[model samples]
Target chain A: MKYNAAFNPSGGAAIVGLGMTEMTREYSYSATGLAGIAVKRALDDAGLKKEDIDGLFINAGVTNAISTPLQTSLGFRDLKLLNHMNAAGSTAGQMVQFASLAIQAGMASHVVCVFADDPLKPGTSAGAAYGGTSNRSTGMASLPASYGFFSGANTSYALAARRHMGLYGTTQDQLGAIAVSTRAWATMNPAAMQQKPMTLDDYHGSRWIVEPFHLLDCTLVSNGAVAVIVTASDRARDLKQPPVYIAGMGQGHPGNPRQAGYENEVNTGARIARDTAYSMAGVGPDDIDIRELYDCYTYTTLVTLEDYGFCEKGEGGAFVEDGKLGPGGSHPTNTGGGQLSGYYMWGMTPVSEAVIQTRGQGGERQVQTRDHVLVSTQGGILDWHSTLILSPNADAGTRN
Target chain B: MTNQDQAVRPAPIVDESSKPFFDAAADAVLLLQRCNICHAYLWPFREICTECLSTDLSWAPSTGKGSVHSFVIMHRLFHPAFQEDVPYNLTVVQLDEGPRVTSIIRGTANEDIHVGMSVSANWHDVNGTPLLHFEAF
Candidate 1:
């Protein structure tokens, strides 16, 4: 891929703090309240006061519960930058990317990126929050819903997975390998929700939500919040925790026309985002030691691995069939069990894990070689994509 | 459950941009938006041509033939209206005109549906509203 000079935000910023609330299916607080706690925790983690944070970037989940008012609710005054971003799962990486650029441009010194949601409501099924039809039953919106195409992401991703399976012969067991491997990693992480050992048989026996997707293939529905503080790389060295350098940042939004010859279902925006991120980081896929990908579904992980060039586009199923992504495997992906088994805080699930692993704070789940980590966040039905290459070494990549 | 107690299935509430499509559906005709300037076919009803940004568009009758591009068997009940239709085939048909439409495939079992299977557009009624569906050919 050709390198673009204007896209270089490498080594300009670093994550200095991380904060998260307990992941749970029961709702204990509003999304704003959770965000406030997370921001406070992050400030304490970074050993900084609330006054030190001049920038705030907020991303709300399905509920759209958290927004710009979070700054005021947190008693933040005179913030230099404050914006609510929503690129779906890609918002976290987009927040970090914008924070890096803003810090590099001298717009703000310390920025906080937070995502919070309380999608799990009382007396509702786990899928209800996401399954509800928000679209008006009129015009083009009603067309899909009128035909029993109700569940939003579940239906869309199942269709995409089916297409991939049809085109490339991807099997159900191949997808099960992802769920099993991610579950294995979840057993090691204390913060993970599903720590019970899961086997391929367990995955196969799981109830089918959609034809191509088993129940285990879907992510958990948790109510929680995650926050990270970003600042200049030079200043991060003096912070309380080891700085996770932002080596590269890139985003891609490839609109789906929902027509033939478009191929958005199989060919995702991750390919374009990967090229930009790899170019900015001055490293190839071989250089990364850990992959903290956004695994909203098992098929997502498989397709992302292929899109990131870990394997050929159509060969992801065969590549992961041998348990390569589990513990003690060649490739350590979703080291924190990802959103599937981990807390589903959207993109923050992968971003937080990448930061933890890079800072050597992963405890038992940490990879030995944590020099370089690749974090990916996908939004919509593979429509939006963002990639981040984080490293322990501040000088790992070429400086702008 | 009695018929009156059954949940009502959702029907398309047509708007200005999609009025013509639903109007054509009432006559059992599959109509797609086409740009007069670029002659590009648009799906899901669009005001302007995506290729040439031309607003001079009109609905034209389609060949009503296509192939199943992809499909899924929805096992879980996401909506109460479709309670009895669990494990039904929700298919995406790739029209020969180059656009894809989401509809249920009739006259075939869920297991029988496969990619590239030939299908033709057909109309079904929901609460007296006509909706487009496909039947395997």
Candidate 2:
């Protein structure tokens, strides 16, 4: 129940394991099968038996929200310790943190956090839905008497970006810079959806999915699952690898999904969520060396970096343009090719990279040496969100 | 509210949870937002008004008109269920009463649309009652 201000988690409740199925939308396997494959792999990585897991945290997939895959996966009949934490879209880092907490709290010896998605509706393109999901359910008719919502993720952010551009004089190239650098990072990540190097010319030349957020600025979507395990900090001490602690956690929902011609950062969920996580971890945005943000949309990552306390509220567009989040940059992100470049597996794949980075396992895109990492998770997976800061020390108190 | 009487006006499938919303949509007039302490004109009827952060909201009428603040054309439908509506245009129109509502844009061609254009309310007779869409003036 107590944590030390300097408690290093290098051997505490670390991620002893990780697993992921290939990213694709055309798979015939059920969502459960996908999760099981990933879960088994995570356990294998942890060097633990399936029975060692005592807690369950599930994100069956965004499209699988109302589905039965969460329970059916793992083929578990004799379920023991289960913590059903459902903050959709914020991330796989949340899952890892959930496992870490279950261990720290003694609720379970080891927790298997499984999330997978066939996010792409079958026969459709191999893609994932960005920050928003169409809320229409069958059998119900839309009210015919007045104006209804026609907005989706792109338009939603466009309004905000337009206001930012209008108020702060933000530019298309500032936005374009993010896409360029993100594409550059994606080339390094084989799993990212867009791996080809993108230039400002390519960014400007790309077709617009929504005005301002052209094809290049958008993130790609795919199908895949990423899972991991966290055991008692004591048990982690003897593991084959080092450990990463859940230093902090945060999640959020926009106060208003639409922009009312005003661009106020606090109205957005980033600062609120970031503050809570920082308070929990005792660290500031300047402390972390790496970030695994949800890049379901280009602005998704750009805006989040600002919201996570990395820079002044409106400065995200400028932050990424400077190459700070690229290879060999001060604070790198999506090293394995984010949803933008790599596969779009419901944004959880980035969390796996966070684990790898914290474990110093990122091969080429790896930070020089990651003693600390901040993993941000989000998407339209429930109109939800969350951020988890992981460290090599478990007992270290807050970082801020 | 009865078994035999159900035949006359079939019991609404939506319960206390969805009745108010369906009722407003059925009426063609959007509902005003209400708070636990004050039942005020909260446009875009919601479960709770952000004003008081209270769940005690009641339905009220809203002036169904606004300007098109923003939009999207959904050039393609991600799911086959929406195939017929492919390339449908969606817009965020701020209502006269203040809530910004988004829905399909009608009464205008995609080529004619532009920022700051004036738009008004046009109910879409989707099925049971009028569903709100938009028209540019």
Candidate 3:
């Protein structure tokens, strides 16, 4: 009994609206200002009012830690079903999963999934994320920290890259291609952070921050918010625009925090999540025109090609070369530029891209031909990953 | 609470869940692994036993004996904070009690560290606190 999004599929739930605020490193507005802008735009896109909303999904950072109802914040007294999930960065994908489950369960008529930041307030530091330093450790700071094996996210990635380079013989150029293609994709996106086209030489010439990984391989954090609205598929047809049917979605935690980011789980995890989505949408990986794996870093996208079953393990390094993940290639990942160049709301862009691809509205960055696109969500440093399958129409899994 | 000194700040510190280990480290006697079901040797201290998974674990003294299971030279510094310690030795020493303890292989160059070599624990007290480092037997 394969669970399809149509049979047990979340057919009723559809993303009817989307919204986002500008990404800025400096504080132009408070996090609430960014969150309000995004939430307001999503409501506007859905053609719905503040009082019309029944549920809210809020994430916290400098721009977003507060979990308040829309009515309370915007001067209304009639909002219900508030859901707050705090993931490191994969808040967007996590919110979608929560919303889908809530909507499918008939808990809310309208669900708003949001990612906003308030984590960067003045008089405060980047906290534990700068390093693997967590407030929740009783194991006595070990050699990994005392020896400085991992002082920050950059160093942690460096440690993992060393192992990956040692194990799979992944080349520096292969890593650069991941950065290059994302920057190329970012060139097509107007709202992207770094939209300039970069060459392989440019990537090589870039300053090497950590060993193997250069400056281009890292993600930039900004103060902003991105939001989406979901309603049942039944109401999707009656909405102001076409709906991108919720095909399949799943999430997972990493077995090893230190080594999880390099697991290349895209093949195993994405395969299962996709099988469910394809099982629901009645399509397969061959039917996909786009592949959006959560790419917080360059190696992330590189390792997942094999993880997503696009190629065999140890082949992702080679398969990524020569315009493979590029626009003309079979799979175009990070079309919205990815975290490397685009707005990274924790796999948010890919979710929006899936909607855009299915609706055939990804202006300038649209794939020539596509259907049953798979969107992946990351939990943190690849410590966890999730998958969601989307399509233009309803796909109920047929009993074989 | 206030740091007025440039080199160091003199402030009374408080401890909640980690006072005992600190005191034991002050004694230079490493005690981490614990057995709830049966009293035995342990290296890495935890509330639950890896052997029994029982929540009843108490830290005890160790003989400070182990062997190197695997090691990495790390020609590159893992942290800018430890830049002076570049090319540091990192190893997974399988304790005599069977718990693998991870630590820096000090008093030896990176190339000098080898697998299956006999090793003993050496706790380097930093800031009046013992930070675990190891030496070859």
Candidate 4:
């Protein structure tokens, strides 16, 4: 149960290349097909062939076993490592962390991490696609349904948002600010799903999916896949694409520990994971040039902003209202729209955007300063959390 | 009464740990598991006390009263069973005894229900299957 930091390789790992399929509302390709194409694109982006990938990591909600089909398609003969991680929206960040650890352990030199899903397709139940069978029986399975109180991600998040409002007097206006700002960022990214401008009035006018949550507050359930190639920092320098170093990464579940329902909604697992990531990266919140927070719901982004020390516990409302996260704001966040307006590749959207920005490939929506980027990912009703600090150089954020 | 809507509603499959809870609910009685050692009460039944890890756990009749910790009014039909039940309120009740229970609040419109409002447990007869719900105190 003890982890010795000395065991980790000194050089650190870096994301050498990134690729993803077109973010579509309804994609005709199978999940495996989308994943294979993304993997090949990532390999091509790194200027490497299939033979160059020695490891493979896959995350697709409950269907983590799709690695076999990907390996079959890619024809990876000398694969040295393979792992199937399922941390809900935290999958992308967690997979990248695993890939880094695998390289650091000498288990593999090159790892291709991927996340793909198509929840918008006909007959795709949210439970089957994201909750998994075990997830269905976890929270609200006993009695909530009998009274017509069935559960899902949006409903659960709405409940948490209500608690925050009640506890700290957080207004719908504050939540609207996040939704509005997210759309502004989305409009700048061509890969985003909803690019239309959304103002405070527009957010208020949007219909309610669950009270305390307007339609605009929810994330798009689009069909897409995102992939990234990770290798040793030294090796990444020689690759074709600019390397986004894995400066710091951490994961933890501080809420609901081992329980069924989410014990605490307003505060979440991000608190612990946030500190761990910053400590490992040898950086603080002020050092971050850009933030790609998981925006599965508008409140999610708000809460994470508070948890990660971007603002006070209940001050997220005023912080976002000041236009810090919007275009031309001091702290540019989710420049690629994130899951809110961006393609909902779950957590992979954050990872892809982080890599793109650090490499100076964010086109029109790119941040002014791209030295340090922070990405946060969450899973399962705000229970599981993972955070990553990516930088433009291997020693970008290293402690002196 | 015929259980016409039994198939659509999520039924709690009675098991060794949860049987007593459903049996009590059948009689409109709310039962929660209490640790015989640490005197801690828990929901979503477990064999051992979640607090003390003591196997000596027993069912205790609850006062069936608590306060709203949080709630949400569903505007979307997550499943077909709730097609006609759109806009129903789902709530988390922080029981007086300390454990939180997921239930629905009664006798209040979705707009009226708020956190910290007192709620009391009641029976929800889904076909013949009795389930637990709550009402404003």
Best by TM-score: 1
Candidate 4 chain A — worst ten consecutive residues by lDDT sum? A131-140
**Residues A191-248, candidate 4, lDDT per residue (tens digit)?**
8888898899999999887788998898877776788998888778888998899888
Candidate 1, residues A42-80: lDDT per residue as tens digits? 999998888888899999999999899999899998788
Query: In DockQ, how does model 3 score against the reference complex?
Result: 0.19
User: 1 or 3, which is superior by TM-score?
Assistant: 1
The lowest-lDDT stretch of 10 consecutive residues in candidate 3 chain A is A1-10
TM-score against native, each model: 0.96, 0.77, 0.79, 0.91
List the DockQ of the predictions in order: 0.77, 0.14, 0.19, 0.48
Candidate 4 residue B115 Cα shift, in angstroms, is 1.2
Ranking the candidates on DockQ from highest down gives 1, 4, 3, 2
* Model 4 ranges with Cα > 4 A deviation: A1-8, A62-65, A123-140, A257-263, B1-17, B77-86
lDDT of 2 by residue, A51-122 (tens): 666667787555664233365556554445564555656656567766665566555666777777665665
B63-124 in candidate 4: lDDT tens per residue? 98889988888786666677676778888888888788877887898888988999888886
Clashing pairs counted in every model: 0, 48, 21, 0
TM-score of chain B of 1: 0.92
The global C-alpha lDDT for each of the candidates, from Candidate 1 onward, is: 0.89, 0.64, 0.65, 0.80
Candidate 1: stretches off by over 4 Å: A1-11, A133-136, B1-5, B79-84
State the lDDT at B35 in candidate 1: 87
